[model samples]
Target: MGNLIFLSGQAAIDQIGGVVGPGDIDAQIDQAMANIERALNAVGSGVDRIFKITVYLTDMNNFESVIKMRERYFDKPWPADTTVGVSALALPELMVELDVIATRP
Candidate 1:
């Protein structure tokens, strides 16, 4: 079995602290991706190493914008993903939160 890496995307977003407020869907998605990437790199893996992703969104209707941002993080043969519409996240202002599983050589 290969080594497994677990990361917290929320920590990365906290570093960027962009103009996009916490409640904005697009902004949250973007920050989430950044956080994921940062966490992956910290573990010596990149987004390409990700085998699966689970996304929690405040509203399923915002999936379009989420997909648009996803394109920037992943390319062809994208990682397996599961998204869910949840009533809330760890943070009240967060519109999206992502948790990923990655393999490392």
Candidate 2:
């Protein structure tokens, strides 16, 4: 069986070692993508190796902008994904959070 990896998304305005707060959705999404990329790299994988992803959004109304940001992270044959609008997150300021699953040889 292949190795499995779980990654957490990164955010820019996110506190370096603290909680996230209400922030720009676009910036939050970008940070989350960066976080995911870093996690993948640590395990010798890249975004292209991802097989699945789940996005947690505090506000579903901004889904369009979130999807647009997501497009920059993956290419053709994009990995399967699920987007969920939740009542709240670990941090109130976090408009979006991404989790990823990847396979490695």
Candidate 3:
């Protein structure tokens, strides 16, 4: 509430609700981050305004890739983060998801 914006987890689904990158963790992460940016923009915030993030992945082995991708999305003093590996997600083809907490710009 107030200046805080808590967003629900965003996955790699396209505008038509179809998964964007089946069997591709890197593409899935990019799509998920795009979704996060779109949602934040819609609510008067941007990725720079984000202060925390929670990432979910189907495989923990992809953690390093996620870290590398994060560099493209966030700046220094990167948001506090937590990443978790799960057996599955809502869509079997979905490989990544991101939820964030941000402040209005």
Best by lDDT: 3
lDDT of 3 by residue, 34-88 (tens): 8888988998899899998999888999999888977988898999999999999
lDDT of 2 at 30: 75
User: Which has the higher TM-score value, candidate number 1 or candidate number 3?
Assistant: 3
TM-score of 2: 0.83
Collision count for each candidate, in order: 0, 6, 0
Worst 10 residues of 3 by lDDT: 6-15
Q: How well does model 1 score by local distance difference test?
A: 0.74
**Candidate 1 global Cα RMSD:** 2.6
Question: Candidate 3 has which clashing residue pairs, if any?
Answer: none
lDDT of 2: 0.75
All candidates: CA RMSD in angstroms? Answer: 2.6, 2.5, 0.9
All candidates in order of TM-score, best leading = 3, 2, 1
TM-score for all models, in order of appearance: 0.82, 0.83, 0.95
Tens digit of lDDT per residue, candidate 1, span 1-105?
Answer: 558887644521566464345657776777677777777788788888888888887888989976786688888777788888899776667777788888887
- Between the candidate structures 1 and 2, which one is better when assessed by TM-score? 2
| Distance from true location, Cα of 37 in model 3, Å | 0.8
Stretches > 4 Å off in candidate 1: 8-12, 16-20
Q: All models: lDDT?
A: 0.74, 0.75, 0.88
